[model samples]
Target: MGDDQDIGYAVTAEFYDLLQAETDRRQARRRFAEPAARARQAILDVGAGTGIVTGILLTASAVPVHAVEPSAPMRAALLTRLAALGADQRARVTLHPEPIEETGLVRAVDLAIASNVVATLPPPVRRATWQAVARALTPGGVLLFDPPPETLPGGRETAARLGPVRVGPDLYSAELTLEPERGILRSVFTYRVERDGVLQREEREAFDLWPVEPALLRAELEAAGLHVVQAPHADLVAARRTAS
Candidate 1:
């Protein structure tokens, strides 16, 4: 689950361009359709893995973006992408070499997003991260993010795509588990992938599980002083800070 760092620079790096191509269309639409026409001037993207979301922000809108990412490889890829863009677009991105929870970006932004990023965090961390997102924005700033279906019981079944996993210097056979009852599915087997001797990647994700209903997510947001704006799918949740 924490392998976001590796995926950004290590394994996903080679396929970064391909990945970006596949996601560009959808992100462009979201960028343009995001509500609140006030036109966010400053934005922050948490869990900005490989900066795929970052690239979308740059291409879809003219707003300045601050991307917070922890993976060393992903940050480099993000920088590479920025360098590839037109001079004006390139200047709009400011990279933060840290995770959302740790980022101390001083600017108060109008919007904050932590897309596919939050699903990978542990529960407590997820809550804390959301709190941080709320604190980082100006009054009434919006927070948009998506939680994987595994966040709801019976949702983990969708994560059955099994592939090799990598761990440290040692490699072992592993399998991905789909625990529908837990509303989460994650890598269950040993950390081993083909080619790579020691596993360099491992995933162990747990969401609210069955006992915690998906609607509870909204309650959590409110507890943090944010209100639900829209959640079009089980995979997406968007909210706005309550007016002060």
Candidate 2:
């Protein structure tokens, strides 16, 4: 809906884990593991917010995992989780404090996973980001990503028609009553972020879903000189870069 904004360090820092409450976080990561086992060895998880996929990447295989998350708060949470697992060093993990678009990784990795993060981006930026992914990957390295549905990024028209929906914490659930009669899909993101033992924030960022259709996503990957081995769905895109 707008130019690519950084989303600031604070917001993105804790964004990864928060998204799990709404999106199918586990299945998305599992999708990466099921088809390709060898690709798991050296992974670059783009948009590795708070390490949700980071956690999966570690447990799913005996591979080295590098997570590039632009949000400082999210990195803090990821570090905390990493420390909890006693993986401060042996985990073969590197957490980059930058967005995937800004990262300049040279060696081709076995896999690159960009979850729901890419779908919301405007077309040009998305193209540029995917191109970066392709360049950083080896030929045949899988590129997986998933965009959100029409329920995000301020798709108010659909929300309004969908009517009321409740979401959030066990006790404090956020409620939304859409009036799609006026073309709006109302929703609420109820999540909290804690940084370095400090509870920093609580907020809801609404979405009017700007879904990137699966067909279009596949076409985009192919256009970028990559093979679309699998289409996007439930926040997953399985693809590979073409051989030069």
| lDDT for 179 (candidate 2) | 26
Query: What are the runs in model 2 whose C-alpha is more than 4 Å off?
Result: 1-5, 8-25, 88-90, 148-170, 175-202, 207-209, 231-235
lDDT of 1 by residue, 66-137 (tens): 888777766776778778789998788788776666776533787887766665566676677777787788
TM-score for each prediction?
Answer: 0.69, 0.70
User: lDDT score of model 1?
Assistant: 0.61
Judged by whole-model lDDT over C-alpha atoms, candidate 2 comes out at 0.60
Leading candidate by lDDT: 1
Top-scoring candidate (TM-score): 2
- How much is the lDDT of residue 175 in candidate 2? 29
Candidate 1 lDDT for residue 17? 46
